[model samples]
Target: MTPHMNTRRAAALAAVAAMVVVGVQTGTANARPAAPDDGSSASPRTSSPAFSSASARTAAIKSAQTDASSTAGSLGLGGKEKLIARDVIKDAKGTVHTRYERTYAGLPVIGGDLVTHIASNGKLKGVTKATDARISVPSTTAKIKTAAAARKVIWAGSGKPVLAFESVKTGVQKDGTPSRRHIITDATTGKTLHSYEAVETAGVGNSQYSGKVDLSTTASGSGFELTDGDRGGHKTYDLNQGESGTGDLVTDDDNTWGDGTGNDRQTAAVDAHYGAAKTWDFYKTALGRDGIAGDGKAAYSRVHYGDAYVNAFWDDSCFCMTYGDGADNKSALTGLDVAGHEMSHGLTASTANLDYVGESGGLNEATSDIFGTAVEFFADNATDVGDYLIGEKIDINGDGSPLRYMDQPSKDGGSADYWDSSVGDLDVHYSSGVANHFFYLLAEGSGAKTINGVDYDSPTSDGSTVTGIGRDKAIQIWYKALSEYMTSSTDYAAARTATEKAATDLYGADSAELKAVDAAWSGVNVK
Candidate 1:
């Protein structure tokens, strides 16, 4: 599976637009502090001009709306085209960034959202959109009933339930699935306007991270299949050494599977099954989420994808997770955290739906990392003790170095330790450092520390000391913010606002949780 896909590309453009939008919105085009060259300091200062009166806020909002409207027109949108402002940020200097949802002819376009960047002097810089395609439908009438369309969707997936109906212009394909095609059934005609795979499936498998684990299996007429009767009927398939085909399901006579060694291919299947179960339990038990999609449905897993594929991914198209045998097939990418990381992608899609670009894109990747780390801690497996380092067991780097370091994200040599205007230019994985560092600070604070026998040293941008709010509280705040407050266009500043609101909702408005949320963002140079 390719880590850098269309999702990342789309997000990159969005990030660039968001950065421009943020610079203008916060009126911080001039006041925004630059990140340290060495990535050692988090001392980026943001000037907050007080808007004490309601009239001031109203004026700011109106100014942003006007700017967005003008920019929309410049982008060739007609007077009938509506740009509904979703979010507006006005910095102390009067610069504005307006996030908008576009409507063409009274119909909502899926990828028509954009961020408008306006300078304090009202100069239009540019606009960023998910897609530039013109949105138009032949007719609004549908020849199919909602129930019948829903039935057709279920039939397409062979039983996967319908999620929702979305309006989309361009049907982008991913992983051989029509990811953006929505089953839009016309109310008047009941006809299927456009149909695509709504259920996204990515493949994932198991490895040696959790050691031996108990698996749920069903007894078929011939023998026991790899399907799990419990846990949403999740099943594991063997891909053998091929890269494409979904291999046969492992079957056994006695219902017992795997010998705890690679000699038995089913051994990896056992690990994959166990890891999926554990991840499900973690989400449900800790966060009150039922499953990856919070729909009480289970996603399948594919093991041994390709010969030494060295990667795993959660593909929304297939609505499943796929894993590969790392390096010479001796190592499988199916660690507990890996499982959690891949599965969390599904959760992110269902929840925040954070576009994989800029700061929002970084947050998208970090969400998976955060949950992956949480899952590791949740499992408390002795063989794979929880640590802030990501992808430690699989040895992807070939030098035994972890893929990322939460304590000091820059330690990986590519990730940013603090947020900078240029951070959006980096790959989503590397840009994710800012949020990973923020999470570490929120959970473990700044300075040197040791966790699960691993050494770590985290620093702040402004050099202000931070006291931890504990991982449990930190995760709760982040999750609540992601699920409730965050949107597809959320950037660093918006994230700060979201977390503050989450903390207020969880604790009182005047609670320390809110304070910690602020301090943690500051530590990561988000402010």
Candidate 2:
């Protein structure tokens, strides 16, 4: 799995941002009308007890905001600090998590966001802040144009090409990179105020799994380099059991590659390359996204990472994907869905930039899983048909079981089938079950079903059968919500709003698609 930050850095950040909420009093179930059991409810009954009353929730949020503002000084906030409540997640247990944005001296502080966990008795249990530094900037002057700065970033090729403005607290990022170095650019001057790494690196050659695939090769003096001149000059490298260098650029005189077996090292490369190409096509053709960043640029892939390495990851630092040969170096972990899942991490980073922790982190993982499944379906390969199971081809569990089941995520020991207050406590991978289940219910509805020879029996939280809006509509709604409506701090409640908004935008306010979106969230207990 691709972690949002390096393991050590992430742990350090977590320590700084940790919050604890103790003594939660469980509340009684507050139910409304239920969806029709005929699997054709035009408008389903809302199942979110916490958010059922809009006015009450809004009042609670206002109270939480006032409480947060009153304790600003105690929380280490400056005099001019303002807290804007972004979301309020309340559990049936009466515990509340209030997410907020901080503004200092009337300017938004990029990393000054925090979450306040309140006990059922209205006692402030703890607070989690991304950064505790005071917000202060020397100046907002710029000597470089925004376009030029972005161009410089692209030319440097150290990371993806994107720019923003943020005040520097310390002089370095968690990774020890220089921070707050870019000058602020005026709209007329085309200068931006801040810069962050946008590219994420992590992938296949004529893939062993995808059979023959189109390769973008450049002619070298000796023969040909495994570089795709067409797809933003993307390339694939063999790590050769070594941990670091970009290995060698695969080359061939005849341009015929791989023998579909691990004995021939190039077979894994073929799978990876083909997977990358197909993933690119999935985004472009299905969702109108140009590339991982929607910038028409390509990312590179590294295979044969370590001895018997059983995992793959997308590293934003190098803007590349890395894969390990599983078990005895026989499983290359570069299947179509695997490639799509890894690459979608880059997309999630560039787009929603969902915080890789708690519920948002689960959404991030589920986003990758959703797109991975979509990519598999888009390919329509005879060898590997699309299914709702994640990592079905990788055999990561060593027992022939898939890593996750979207239809009923609880089928896996770790995943949760429905949303709950404690869902956020689980690992992001397991917490992702809520969103995956929601997507499955949205696309295929509730009940026993079979898709591409795979059987699925999805149940609803309130025993209400749901009628699907079809996978095509479901994907469209999810993609629009992810790319346009969702933000870095979006959680399950906000996700419900985003998907509803997306469906309304794409299929009209009174359309069945919108109804389906609402029903799907309700089915997952998100409401």
Q: Best TM-score goes to which candidate? A: 2
lDDT scores of the candidates, listed in order? 0.67, 0.69
Looking at candidate 1, what is the lDDT of residue 168?
Answer: 43
Which ten contiguous residues of candidate 2 have the minimum total lDDT? 18-27
lDDT of 1 at 236: 89
* Residue lDDT tens for model 1, 370-428: 99899999888888889998888777777887878899988888899999899987867
- For lDDT, the strongest prediction is 2
lDDT of 2 by residue, 1-527 (tens): 23444453254222211000100001111111111000223433322225557787798778877877676766766676788887776643356778888775565555567877778897888877666555544343334444332322111112221223432222533333333443333333354434433221111234566665666555443245567665666788898986676788776654667777777888888777777878888887777565786545688888887788666766554566667787789888888888888888778777787776788878988888899899999999887888998877777777888878899998878788999999888867778899999999999999998888999999999999999977777888888888778987888999999999988877789988899889989999996
Models 1 onward score TM values of: 0.62, 0.63
- C-alpha RMSD (angstroms) for model 1: 14.8
What is the model-wide C-alpha lDDT for candidate 2? 0.69
